[model samples]
Target: MKPFYEKTIHTKPIFQGRMISLQVDEVELPNGQTSTREVVKHPGAVAVMPFTTDGRMVVVRQFRKPLEKEIYEIPAGKLEKGEDPASCALRELEEETGFAAESLQLVTSFYTSPGFADELLYIFEATGLTQGKVHPDEDEFVEAQLISLEEGLELMAAEQIHDAKTVFALMYWQNKRLKAQLGK
Candidate 1:
């Protein structure tokens, strides 16, 4: 079967910025009606789920301006123009958590918010961690912590970790671990 939403008409960017762009599009609905959809174009991003040798997960505590509060999340960053997701994942992991991974594997990729924004997030699993100096952006402020996988699950259950990307990555790993334990 074909998709329901079809792009009947689209207008190029009215304005562009470092992180996003404004675009207007006309789409045909499933009900055979036409409508306009304003979209925010993003350059996509990468999130890293770093695991220490001792089976601990590396998390970052940062104060998000939009939330106006410190939140715990996995290491993540937006991709620079012409940069690859894997490279971005490695760079962000080291920059945010002060740990470099010898092996980085792509876990999954998904859209952050499909309602209006076109932000695709690529998640990676980083292993073989080695300590380094955190080189966060000058405007960025964050604290890194290494928590056990069990502790991370507890944090999720306690509603302490609320970021969507972080939650998704943790749950994905958790499910994988459970399946492995059950010999499936």
Candidate 2:
């Protein structure tokens, strides 16, 4: 089967910014009509679900300028140019939460918003945690909170934690743990 949308023409790099770039493209639709799309290019990012030995999860409360409100989320950050996702995950976890993980396992990856942006997020499970000094960005205001896994789930159910990436990572962990217990 052939795809409905086919790229007929493309205008590359109308503008580029630190976080994203703009590309104008023309595509031929299934109905034999052409349309233009302004695609946003992103450098991808990483998010970490840090679990303490006792089964507590580390999260951060910070203000998101886009949301214009403070929200709780798992530690995450955008990848620097040419940086590995694992390195970015570890760095972001430590910088935001003052904890370092001895082992980080890649859980899954997903697009943040496939409809509009090409932002791919790599999710990781960080374990074997050790306390460290936080190295947050100068402009970043964050407070780290360690909550029980059960409490984290409750927060999600209560609508307190609304970040999509965080929810996805936590849910993935929950499902994995349940499967492990069932096998025991």
Candidate 3:
């Protein structure tokens, strides 16, 4: 058996929305105790860090309802049913930033919040970006921003880049920079 496994005894679906589903689960703990878990099920997502040929990083600023604020972040979107992560990344890049990537490389895949949510996020580093048409979703209102890598680092240090995926992508970029400098 897996470590600290919780066997679900019952699951009560609370709400089913377009992007996520909420459920309350009654689970039996490994030590034979029963507990309740409020879980958020998400259909996964993809985030891209696109860098222009001129070395500027493309980001987006949008108003988030949950945060009740406009924040800058890397381009990202949810994965549609039966959609691959790379495809989702490319689509989001073009739709949100008006840029198409000539080279799309997967950086990593991670769970956004493993404590109470099952939302997996796939991150990619996109280079050789070319200007394209902007076409975001009907409900999405995004403003693209192109900044240097140093500016992105400053934004993160100023606590402006708050999202997990965006932060991780930036870290990935930093690591790539280090590796390149080290001639690895």
Candidate 4:
């Protein structure tokens, strides 16, 4: 694996924005050749799978401009510089869904799209939720909904829940349930 590594020779910034930046890197390929790779750098993010006391999951419905339609997804937001993922998860859950979790656990973390982007997302499972006032970002227009895990899966099958983070979170939640049922 080390023999196949591409070492970065130089990086040229193409664009920089508040949320993401684009860069092109000149790399020394494993085969002794040089190539350019375009990459998108992001500030990573956190996604929360909030479960209520009655076994319902809290999700958010919002219009995604890139998709040009509304979609349902777990509460998520980009991490502030130097912010811990768990803290970001809790903040996003409360801000978007108006529910604060009494118990929040880190389930996993992964890069959303490693082929071209470096945006990693930390996923958390939150339980024992208490309702509060929603304080979504001024630019964020989101409405929270509570649904059973079964319903969440159904929505996924219907393509209504299409975001990667939400899909992964729901699948993780279901896998945990199956494991519990099997006593594994």
Candidate 3 local lDDT, 74-167, one digit each (tens): 9999999999899989999999989988999987889999999999998898998889799999989999999887898898888778888878
Cα deviation at 42, candidate 2, in Å, is 0.6
Residue pairs in clash, model 2: none
lDDT (Cα) of model 3 = 0.90
Residue 83 Cα positional deviation in candidate 4, in Å, after optimal superposition: 0.9
lDDT (Cα) of model 2: 0.88
TM-score quality measure for candidate 2: 0.90
lDDT of 1 by residue, 1-184 (tens): 9767575665767779878998888877888888888888999999998988787889999888888777789999999989999999999999998998999999889999998899999999999999999999999998999887788878888877888998887887788789989999
Q: What would the C-alpha RMSD of candidate 4 be, to one decimal place? A: 1.3
Residue 54 displacement in candidate 3 (angstroms): 2.2
The alpha-carbon lDDT assigned to residue 119 of candidate 2 equals 95
| Local distance difference test, each candidate | 0.88, 0.88, 0.90, 0.93
Instruction: List candidate 2 segments past 4 Å from native.
Output: 12-15
How many clashing residue pairs are found in candidate 2? Answer: 0
Clashes per model (N, Cα, C within 3 A): 0, 0, 0, 0
Query: What tens digits encode model 4's per-residue C-alpha lDDT throughout 34-69?
Result: 999999999999999898877788999999999999
Worst 10 residues of 3 by lDDT: 167-176
> What is the lDDT for 139 in model 4?
99
TM-score of 3: 0.95
In Å, residue 71's CA in model 1 sits off its true spot by 1.0
TM-score per candidate, in order?
0.89, 0.90, 0.95, 0.95
Residue 27 lDDT in model 4?
99
Q: Say what the RMSD of model 2 is.
A: 1.9
